[model samples]
Target: MKLVKSLVAVAITVSMFSCGNQVKEVKTLNTEIDSVSYAIGLNMATQFKANLKEVNDDAFIQGYISGKDSTNLLVAQKDIQTIINTYLRKQQTAKMEEQRAKAAKEAEAKFGDNKKAGEDFLVENKTKEGVITTDSGLQYIILKEGTGDQPASPSTRVKVHYHGTNLEGEVFDSSVDRGTPAEFVLNEVIKGWTEGLQLMKEGAKYKFFIPQEMAYGAQQRGDKIKPFSTLVFEVELLEVLD
Candidate 1:
């Protein structure tokens, strides 16, 4: 009986690895098979492999272990492997789904508040071209216009000089601070930028009243901006590439 079980396990291992097109599938199948096999083998190894040597009659071993009588044991081994494979596959799939749900919940929680703040700013300012609104609700007027080609769509690289400030008149980031024009793809910039630049021709300067939503929403503007901040940018459309 012990020799019969050992032979059955070995035969199943051989058959599993034999199919050509199923080679990769079989390797994954084998990993699951090996896990169960390891548990079973550890529990039964002494009886299945070592005790066979103590059997006194060779004919009794050959009749019961080698020929037609071994068929039932082989069937049983295949059934056990099938059961273990089904169990582990279901366990892993459930774990993955649980992780996905957790990630989605966290994102909604983090971004929801900021999005609401942006919507509030939009309601108060009512978006119009060339208007400037500051964090504490002060506004500025555009003083000059430049002569340049205007961007018609989201597609275009632009060059500009800009100064930003709060309602209390504190300067934030400025291209003037670096004494050079800021260059970037218009479509790749913030919503206020993409919208405002489209309204100006290359060499045209416009003062933009960027509400928090159109700028950075309720998010902090790097080290320079605070939550629920509106911004003023005096932008010059120096050039448009493509």
Candidate 2:
């Protein structure tokens, strides 16, 4: 409907431009009605120039005259709005896709190195003793083994203390530092935590080397956790609450 209004404004400008020769004959706008009409015409012309670049002036003026006279309309009045709305929707979709593509390119340029560093770190770390790499690219080492039962499913809620850090060992978050155990359903966490925690029994402590794809991926969490970052965490399984 907004686009329709803009098109109407453009059409008014086109109508005035088309009738420029006839308007020149009436030079003086002495009456208030005449002055107001001229001023609105000027405003419409300015709006058309600012809002639209490409318009068929001849067809627009012809359509305007036909519409005003209520005769010889090429399109039915009911169908005109539908056609215009469809065109406007397509334009909006194309513009949104263009913006997303531009944003993706910019993100890759900034975070490409972080992705490469994670890949390199994983390649070297996988060869170390006690470090186990899974099919999903999650790596971890059992720090303290437990004998209790493992969680039954990803939906099971569990309590645990964890110290999380970036690749540079800069701590980003920690329930351990706050002196409280965090608790949630395993499915609600990152892919790495969900998968890795399932491998542990109650009272188990594990150090995880989570790849970016299994962690936050391209999302920047805070000032400390940049986009495409691999995360490290020391997790202790306190209790399986359900």
lDDT of each candidate versus the true structure = 0.61, 0.83
**Colliding pairs, model 2:** none
- Best by the TM-score measure: 2
Model 1 segments more than 4 A misplaced? 1-142
Local lDDT at 188 for model 1: 89
Model 2: per-residue Cα lDDT over 99-183, one tens digit each? 8778656877999998899999999999999999999999999999988879999999999999999999999999999999999
CA shift at 154, candidate 2, in angstroms? 1.4
User: Candidate 2, TM-score vs. the true structure?
Assistant: 0.60
RMSD per model, one decimal: 15.7, 7.0
- Which 10-residue span in candidate 1 carries the lowest summed lDDT? 16-25
Best by lDDT: 2
Question: How many pairs in model 1 have backbone atoms within 3 A of each other, for residues 3 or more apart or on separate chains, i.e. clashes?
Answer: 13
